[model samples]
Target: MTSASRTFIDHAVSKVPAVTLGFWIIKVACTTLGETGGDWVTMSLNLGYLVGSLIFLAGFVVLVSAQIRARNFYPWLYWATIVATTTLGTTLADFFDRSLGVGYPGGVSIILLLLITSLGVWYRAEGTVSIESVASARVEWFYWTTILFSQTLGTALGDWVAGEDRGGLGLGYEMGAVIFGAALVVVGLLWLWPRVSRTALFWFAFVLTRPLGATLGDLLDKPVAQGGLEFSRLYASVLLLIFIVGCIAVLPQRAARRASAA
Candidate 1:
């Protein structure tokens, strides 16, 4: 074979799924599961935020290490890593916002700073923040780090919008979900515009979907008096888990292709 052809064939594929409708569907489901699952461990089991964070963080480390070591994309492993991030993000955000008394606004600010810093460092090192660039272990590290921060930020933001105290917007869980969902729709519409930056839109939508899932989770599990269905967190989590697994089993997921050089 020609040297150039060999090089082309040998290029590393991204270890992340292609962006598609199914991708977003599973993402939202996983985020919702994160919320309920985290609550199950922390609130239902009385482990509290700190202990829950530690537990999920351990899982995050394990799964992320496995993801980075894999030579190619494994859909189940990739999605499991995402779930770990979301669950860890939930408890960690709670620890900072509630346990540390930082409040939701403070938590949001801190996490947003972390997210931006991760992205800035990633861009400086890799010259691109696109998911398509996540073809190497180093880039995968940056991707997961950024995702962790985004998930944490989304939890705090969702709580702030839904809560009635600490200068919260008092939208309640249902309304908060509506607002974030609308924002995602807008982001999706922007994706169709030729001049829009897809990388930016993808991240924006990615961040928004977390809070959308968060609020939906809250709506399902919180007390009816608090504008929720008061469903058991364990039950909600199990149902969401089933749905996510089903989607992963049935959906057509493909590893994102590396972008051609401009």
Candidate 2:
């Protein structure tokens, strides 16, 4: 498709899936895989966060380029980019927490600030933070940056909650997941109620899902010694990956049919 035609049809194409149950299911799966797969590459192999991050960053660049080049939304390509973000987020968050010795709270605070800044800048630049406006390159850049920050923030928050007496907030991973999940329910109710910006509500839920998934992932894989079920990280991560692939395979992920005028 011609560049002009591609841009026009983009609007008609699905910018994002509906905020339904399936979306959250896939999202948490991706997030869990992000936690374990990232650890597999970085900690298991002893590659170090810097080297692991560089690898994932390169992958992110390639996947993002492919995503942007597509004439319409391709589920594989789009979701691949998301996986890239989560993996990258994993190593990046570790870099901050370990390398900088910022601890989980410090890392979470810094990443959260950056996320807020990216959103504020994007909204100021284009007057919207809605996914529906994620067509142009400028908005796309902002979108990806915000996503990276949110994922990283999720990692930090998960660590903070699940860690033992670190910041005096030791709810453990299961409890953390429950808390975040509860918060999500409240947010959903608020969104369904009066006076919430759909755009704002969407982003709020988007950010919360990351931590929810992160904590849940840790709860499954961390050792019983560490308040988890002692399940193998690889096993849990693989299961999540299979579920994600199955969902993508069965779901109707196609973009809308193009209009003749476009």
Candidate 3:
């Protein structure tokens, strides 16, 4: 085989999509959809948080199973699993924060612990938690578990910052979006310096996108009196889904280049 062909195959080995502008666009949109769609199921539909969590959890299990079983990167399936995780994260956060009376601050604290633990364990077992190292089923399991925790943490953290609690920034949705957006910009800039760890930056960007989505989603769907446009959750979710599909179709998507552990 030609060297060029070998290079292409090597890059195509990762099931996860390469970190790119298109990837971020879809990821942020998916998280936004998770917020609105979860609300649509739980609040607008009157199913409550527990039911919503169960529903999304089931979807996550099924889609993630399919994603793991697949031999190559399938953009649609990969994205579907992501949406399932974010949606599950949304409902689970609500259940813990509201139903269980843990509140946003408490929820954020707890989820962050889980996230840290997941990464620590993954790194210990695999020697690295980098996306490029995700080549085996065992590593992918670690990958998805860490993602699930991160998504949950993102939702709780986003709500904590945007909420009116005295312990948090209480910045509201618009300001919350601005804060995460600026943070993401800083991470992107840090990427330019080679000394900075790309794996670390990638995960930072990943976690940051969810809150950006949470704030943006809440800004669109919450009542006008609550500093939002009060759009119907179902309608907002549909629009976000359409945008995600359109981006996947229009933009380039390819798997990450497989490499050594960090």
Candidate 4:
């Protein structure tokens, strides 16, 4: 095969885990970390919500740009971008819910709508939303946009479930995590069963990951009074970062598949 052709293949599909069980496990971990870590920088550090959002948003842009510019899939780079998205999601959602006074439900509703719009546009423009076909900038743009929304939506939903009062289900953080996790398992089984639209299943899991992270993160860092461990957010973020980096180094993470057209 020509070097050019080989390169294209490398850029298309990810050579890393294809949203498998391991992938979801790591994804959930990162999301939870995103919650704690994001709060650490924004709330704990006294960065202020606006400042924190700007900081994370900048980081998200930088990491995502780097990921996009990469020659192929680098697990570390890709996952870093994912973590960035989740962190930004946490801050952004909080800003909307608390600062804007939208409340959790309203914030969630808005983000969910945006998320749907992003997916619809992506599908309309690309004719496919499969993770396997993330070959070009256009497709990648859609993928990232959708991801950003999902992460944000997850935070909002987490708050809606665990947040006290205001129509809150008041499930608490741990219970919320369990509920979302169980839902994910059911979705997985349905995904495995034949006759389900693969695309639909993919989106379902993608959306679920965000809330899973949100609730899980809350479970880790919330006070005992609120049903959390009262762990330090900074410590949790740093630890999660370490685990992700170590796993990337040890595991078999491949670069993105090259585009067929490349």
Best by lDDT: 1
Per-model TM-score versus the true fold: 0.95, 0.90, 0.93, 0.91
Whole-structure CA lDDT of model 2: 0.80
TM-score of 1: 0.95
Predicted candidate 4 versus true structure: per-residue lDDT over 1-262, tens digit per residue: 6887666656555533455556776788788888999899988998977888899999988987787777656777788889989999999999888888878888888899999899899889878777766866677778888899989998999889988965578988878888888988998899778999877887888778888888878877889898988888888888888887776676555443334532
CA lDDT scores, all candidates in order:
0.89, 0.80, 0.88, 0.81
Model 3 lDDT, residue 211, Cα: 90
Candidate 2 per-residue lDDT, tens place, 1-262, comes to 6988675646634544545666777887898889888887887788999999999999988887777666667777777788899889988988888877887788888899999999999999988777766766667788888988889888888888778653627878888899889988988899877788877877777778888888877777788887888777778778888988998888666553343332
RMSD to the true structure for each prediction, in A, is 2.2, 3.3, 3.3, 2.7
**Pairs of colliding residues, candidate 2:** none
Ten residues in sequence with the least summed lDDT for candidate 4: 253-262
Q: Where is the poorest 10-residue window by lDDT in model 3?
A: 5-14
Considering TM-score, which of the candidate structures 2 and 4 is the better prediction for this target? 4
Query: In what order do the candidates fall by TM-score, top score first?
Result: 1, 3, 4, 2
lDDT of 1: 0.89
Error of 2 at 83 (Å): 1.0
Better of 1 and 4 by TM-score: 1
Mark the 10 consecutive residues where model 2 has the least summed lDDT.
Answer: 253-262
